[model samples]
Target: MSVQPDLFDRSLFRIRRHRALKAAKPGADFLLRAVAVDLEERLLLINRTFGTAVDLGGHTGLVTQAIVNAGKAGRVLRADLQVADPNLPLPDLVCDDALLPLGDQSVDLIVSALTLQFVNDLPGTLIQIRRALAPDGFFLATLPGAGTLTELRDSLTRAELEIRGGAAARVLPFADTRDLGSLLQRAGFALPVTDLDTITVRYDTMFALLNDLRAMGATSILKDRSRTPISRRVLFRAAELYAENHSDPDGRIRATFALVTLSGWAPHESQQKPLRPGSAKASLAEALGAKEQKL
Candidate 1:
């Protein structure tokens, strides 16, 4: 089936992501590492070893490293949009996020980290991931959910409206927590589950947050974004608004990052299935000791 129109400038995202990788410091990927840590914890809970795995969008190979360190996967391949910097030790499989280069049922595990939110066709990508997994294989990922950058979004919107009379899309849209589970099911994943973790980061100024976003390759790449760079006047105003509305008692501005963690398995007859209708021996009314009433 066809998917939504391009919401993001995928080419631009790749260019920026490459620049971010080139200019990144040794520990600049702290956020990616944090997500990888959580991914490791989730894998530990499952206690299943994967024979072959793909680390989709494995920025800096942190997720790959986490999986390897945890001994979760026997062999892991890294796939990303750009070749890693030679200075950094990483795999060299450069590929698009939406079009994974893997055969059906080829991989036993797929782990994506903070990557799906940038794809223009997320549903299609998820379906592709599902198709690439072996039966009963696992797909685990974390993407920024709704409310990820509420402070920045609000500040930019208010600043633009007051200064330019209107605002163009300045922030990337994120997946909603409510819709993710259903999306997983639609993508033909079994035992679909989704949960969220909200990380509140404090920045001394709006510029600080923007700097971090740029370094993380998380800057706005909306297809319909303004061609011109943001003006200094609007930017300053946004900083003022952000501080006024989102500052804590200590005067540091709070930025909310809601990470939506998703887990699903490729369908297999061996996996648990829901009970059929009328399969239960006891009625809810009988179990709860309440009278049954006819509607």
Candidate 2:
């Protein structure tokens, strides 16, 4: 069988994220910080405190600070695809997403913030995370869902097709919330729960939105993207199309970012488990006294 092509270039993505962090623009990482805040809130809901934890792909260490502030962990190690600065306040460890550096069942908690979506092998990454977590250990995270950046993707594709007679994959295909639970289960997580929330931010123009994406190190790193730089004419036309189709009453363009928050625990006997098939004692037909029809 032919090997499948990678959806993203992991090396390029790491470099872009490092570049964005180096730029250090004010409010450029507002989205990442926002997700970290939300993740911290969710972590607060868990009653247990972890002894040792790792924040995988923790860019700029915002989530690490959140974990520390909440007293969620006795020790939190920060890991990322690229080590942008070793002198940062947090203790940092450089590692790849698919293969974590920790030993099996060595961590009590594993939290990721605005990461995982960029991984070329998401399923493998989750499996590795599961292996790193001790029994009953928790996993919490917020990542971009399939609906994220839909407007921009549409606008760009339309512009490319019109200007260059074709469209390349310009946006990463983020995982859908519907598939999250299944993936967690497949990765050996217990009591996995997933939900999505949409955040719509309005911008004066498409250029502003694009600028924010670049500053956030979120520009497309699709492996099969066109080697040539984006032409100015194409960008202008895409901006025009975005405004025409996605503009609100105030003349501001609306960008929808659907974030999927996932929570799961490593399997342990103490954790609750679903009953076996055919274990239920009652049926709806009996409770409601409804007539049963056979197919």
- CA lDDT of each prediction against the hidden true structure: 0.88, 0.86
RMSD of every candidate to native, in Å, equals 1.8, 2.2
Would you estimate the TM-scores of all the predictions? Answer: 0.95, 0.93
Task: Using lDDT, give the best candidate's number.
Answer: 1
Clashing pairs in 2: none
What is the per-residue lDDT of model 2 for residues 1-295, given as tens digits with 9 covering 90 to 100? 9876788887898788888878877888789888888888888888889999888877778888889977889998888666544336544688877678889999999888787888777788888888888999988888999989999999999999999999888788888897987899899888889999999999999999889999888999899888988889989999999999999988999999999998889899998778999999987788899986677
Error of 1 at 192 (Å): 0.3
1-295 in candidate 1: lDDT tens per residue? 9756789888888888888988886566777888999998888888679899888886677888878877888999877665564445656487887888889999999999998988887788899999999999999999999999988999999999999999988988888997998899999999999999999989899998899999888899899889999999999999999999999999999999999999999999999998999999999999999998889
User: Against the true structure, whose TM-score is highest?
Assistant: 1
TM-score of 2: 0.93
